[model samples]
Target: MTYTTRADFMSGLREALGRNNIPDARDILIDFDQHFDGGAAAGESEADVCAKLGDVDEIVKQYISETDGRFTEAQKETPVQETVITDNEPEKNMNTGDFAQTAKEASAPEIKNERSGPSAGGIVGVIFMDIFLFSWTLITLLSLIISLYAVTIAFAASGIAIFVGAIMIAAVGAAGFISTGFAPISLIFCGIMMCAFGGMLVIASIAATRGFINLIIAVINLNARRFTGHNVCRKIGRKYREERD
Candidate 1:
């Protein structure tokens, strides 16, 4: 079901856990509640948080499977043996061979399956790419954006100055204090055109700046995932797209 509010989402999760007979349902609900609070603090909506969490049934199934696996592992580690005592049989004592076998089993080394992360070569490659390629490209784009904003400001100031100067010239000419070599009306029109151009540049600069910022963020996230072995941004982007669709 689509959860539109925190209450609805939590209620559904709690109901699902209850139906599944989850022993730690209260603890699971508490974790989910904290997740909602964190999302709210980050300025996310309830619907968004729910979407990121995916379906309640799927979450319950995941927990059920994990709990079952834990139980299975525990059972394997502590196998049960039934002892039958009859009046016809005598108690058997442990021999030297049996004691030695038990001791050897007890002292045996345990081999664990460890998960390995990115190799040294892979880390070095990511570092090289970030330093030599991504860094320079981002720097160049930032510089260009700054220059565009500066030019936009310059154009706007120049336009306003030209417009005011034309008005002043016309006023002085009418008073016979100064000779107006060029038509003040034409100068005013030129000033208006410059202002319009500057306005257009302002819009373009804003769009370019946003695009540059997104690009930089993408590069940084990509490099981070390469070095850390966790694609956090990718997961977020995937969840966002899923919700949007």
Candidate 2:
């Protein structure tokens, strides 16, 4: 009943709103304080004031019932989330309760992010990222294998082309000496076709090399992400927290 210190109010609020809450919980506390102060100034005893308002639990119910009860989009962004890794601990997936409980805890009576917007560490985003990384790794490995095969095939075809071209020119020379123009014409066409094929093989080989290079880059990026990605996401999270507050 004693309208004591801020801590006392906070304790009551915590019991009301719960431990896990978004940043909007802070705003709610501020509002509660203002309400209590107004009531006290209206000639009511401190105990009466407390009793009239009722238990912190009831207050929270009323608070939550409001249309815009608590929370802002900015505040809801990861107000409370922990990376729960079970070091090979049964590898269980998260259930709905985990999230609901987390939200309840994060919301403090003193301050809470009650925005009720999307989850900060959305399961959807996590799933998508997982899928992307897995697919990329698979693709990179496959492309590398294909690139090697392409290059080998090109080299083999180059060897065959050189041999055939040589034979064609020799045949054309013999035709000219025998006074027959048909053989030389056919040989010239064959030479052109062989050269075209060889050029296409070279192009395919080059393309494969480029694809392999891309695969290597993807792998490198994934490795470096453990460091860079952590800090970047942390910084972003902090910024959103401040905005919610």
Candidate 3:
């Protein structure tokens, strides 16, 4: 069945795995949990993440095939009956050899899926990405973030200055040192308003900074995957989300 939410997807997967007697179900669940978390941190919706993950039934079937085959092989290697123990030691050795061979065969596909050498076109793309696209994009994002922070600081400084100046004016007016044009009470109110506005700006700037950082990291990961065939984006996303949380 279609699952739009992480909770539904995970629950369905867990149930399916249990029905199929899949081993290491906990590990499987944890992996999917991280996958959802990573997608969330990358500004993807739960539905989008689930769509990328594909069907729950298919995932369960995959786990069952991989895990159940190993379990069956393990059972076959074990001497369940007394008569089986009477077999020659060489037969036992052969059974162990067969199990090892089966394991190697099972893992072969995973080895093939790892990043391989890039082709000529891939090499050219990587060079272009590194030299122009990536460099300029990173610089622009950093500049934006820095500018936002500078504005935030400027607001905070302005607010503090106004607050302090208002206090000084009130003290001076009470002492009758000089005839200030504006009312001391009005100046104090304006100062408080500036400080409040600055505080709000500080919050907005922090959120903008985080968003820009996430965008920069996403762009880098996209290029890395496109050129190098290294799928580390999800891992980085998970790490970023974890740190933020």
Candidate 4:
């Protein structure tokens, strides 16, 4: 495998393993690097190497299973360490526990005040920054929506205009044929070609309009889902791509 391709595959596998909370992910990634290196040494293409390894999800599942097996084995093989306390050490253990509790309490106030000393100006600055970011995002989103609507409207209007123009051309062809006693075949042919071209333009525009409409609908649905605190767009996109593929 080429360096770039190997890196990409390893990166994806690492992310998949991390998302699944697999243990020793770095070690697994190191193992994968060695595998890729071996494959490259054998002069195999990246695709062929990856095919032998299987899909990222499948690899992550296998890793998870292996990790669980190792954990179980370790648990079974390891001896549990129990604190063997004699009767005389009870007071010592109690004193140690009390000392630890007191130390923890003493540190609590310092931790709490660590970030609680922000000045009034700092608080106001943070508030201003948050408001600025919110306004900027809102403006950007609104501009995008307006731009989409404008483009859709323009496309739909062009479609209607082209349809009307086709009708006019057909009308002129009929009138010319009647006035010329149907004598000029070229005129009739030219008119028919013009009408066809116009019809095609109208059809193309309609298709474009429909595409824009679908895009708008998708955008609206995405925004609605976001507003409702549902992050289903990613899932929907994945499903769509799966079906398309």
Candidate 5:
């Protein structure tokens, strides 16, 4: 359901029309556009559409052959003039150069070959995601989630250990105070600080856990929306192009 090759094919067709001096080039292009759109709506990929259209060079030759008579007649009626080529027309020259560059970039195969991950095969990364191979975005987010969970577990364990230690210290202090009718200020202070530190650790653990959970939920929702939006747009664009063509 991808239309990666459509624009390249259209560009090549346009150039072919120009080379042949076709008078109704725009109309012909529109028809081709419609044909591609119709094919796409029928669940064909851009590569399939292009294959159906056949070779670009062959199509160009066919157009030139079909309109040879009209081209010859037009050339006879058009006046021949001596055009002076000069370096003074830098702006026009620059415009022509820019147009050529733009066309070259647009028709480059890399346009269709770009992947969603570090390696080639964007669609493969999505459909065949594995532990070793997947989208970079997914890998990075998953790593972050794993690290966050690891931190959360460590914090929770530390908090529980500290809390237990604090309870033991407080119980000792209470027992000594009851047995001897006196408790050392240092022991009481130490117990209170340990309990406070343990409580803070527990709170930090909870916060980290909640944050990691929310992040995972957000990532799932975001990826889902992005995938759905892309598909919807692709469908609408295919239909719109078919209608316009």
Candidate 6:
């Protein structure tokens, strides 16, 4: 192609490269413009030059399409944009490439909890979860043992209270007017205390069950071939060799 035709083609090629920048375009341009003065030396007419070079768009496409199994930087780095629609609102949107770069960035999460979603039952739930997760097994194992000792003492004391209260009720005929009926009130209060203690006991039992289950699961994972990337053959051989030694 003539100098003018080659110049026009190269200008467009440069713009396309800026956006899609495939190496194939660079290679094609290299082969197509083998002239010493960069395709100008050919001195062919503009129309004839373009005709020989063929369709510029089709040539660019063909170059990009010749990818072998091996991946270049551009090919390997091409963004795979995936769309995710959660129940939460979409606060930000960008190309997949840019989003991934931001994810790997060494910074704290920009979205704060308050802005992310609605709050829970706040302090009440927090207290219950703390009781369920952190107490008994984690923070108060010894306290729980002490509480067991206290349970034995309380049971013996309450049984005596029950027997004495019954006898008093029969003798004094004053079950209805014992300390202006505060005896029943106090007993009701004791019942509530016992219920709270029972709830705590239940939580402790659940936490212990979960902890032992987790331990079992950990042991199972260690023995499994997939978790440690050891095959059954390797395990059998190791056992056999251990027995021999």
- Highest lDDT model number: 1
- How does residue 126 of candidate 3 score in lDDT? 57
lDDT per model vs. reference: 0.61, 0.47, 0.59, 0.48, 0.49, 0.41
Clashes of 1: 0
Encode model 4's per-residue lDDT on 152-226: one tens digit a residue: 556555555555655555676687643534434544455555556556655655554444444334333333333
Residue 218 accuracy (lDDT) in model 5: 34
Clash tally for model 6: 1
lDDT of 1 by residue, 1-245 (tens): 65877777776876676565665454466578778879999999999999999899999889878776454443344321111111111112111122222222222111000102455775777677779877787789789899999999999888888899899999999899878867888889888988999999999998777566555555554455456653343211222232111
lDDT of 2 at 105: 28
Candidate 5 regions with alpha-carbon error over 4 angstroms = 1-4, 72-245
Residue 177 in candidate 6, Cα distance off native in Å: 99
lDDT of 2 by residue, 1-245 (tens): 23344445545665445444434554455555556568768966556666666666656666556645467666556333222222111112112223322333233322222222334443354345547764675577577667766666765566566557656766766876545446545655565666576677667666655544443443333333332331111111122233222
**Candidate 2 Cα misplacement greater than 4 A, ranges:** 1-181, 228-245
**Residue pairs in candidate 3 whose N, alpha carbon or C atoms collide under 3 angstroms:** none
Q: What TM-score would each prediction reach against the true structure?
A: 0.45, 0.29, 0.45, 0.28, 0.30, 0.25
Worst 10 residues of 1 by lDDT: 106-115
Identify the superior model by TM-score, candidate 2 or candidate 5: 5
Sort order, lDDT high to low: 1, 3, 5, 4, 2, 6
> What's the residue-level lDDT of 146 in candidate 1?
96
After TM-score superposition, the amount by which residue 157's alpha carbon in candidate 1 deviates from its true location, in angstroms, is 1.3
lDDT of 5 by residue, 156-183 (tens): 5655565566566667767765342234
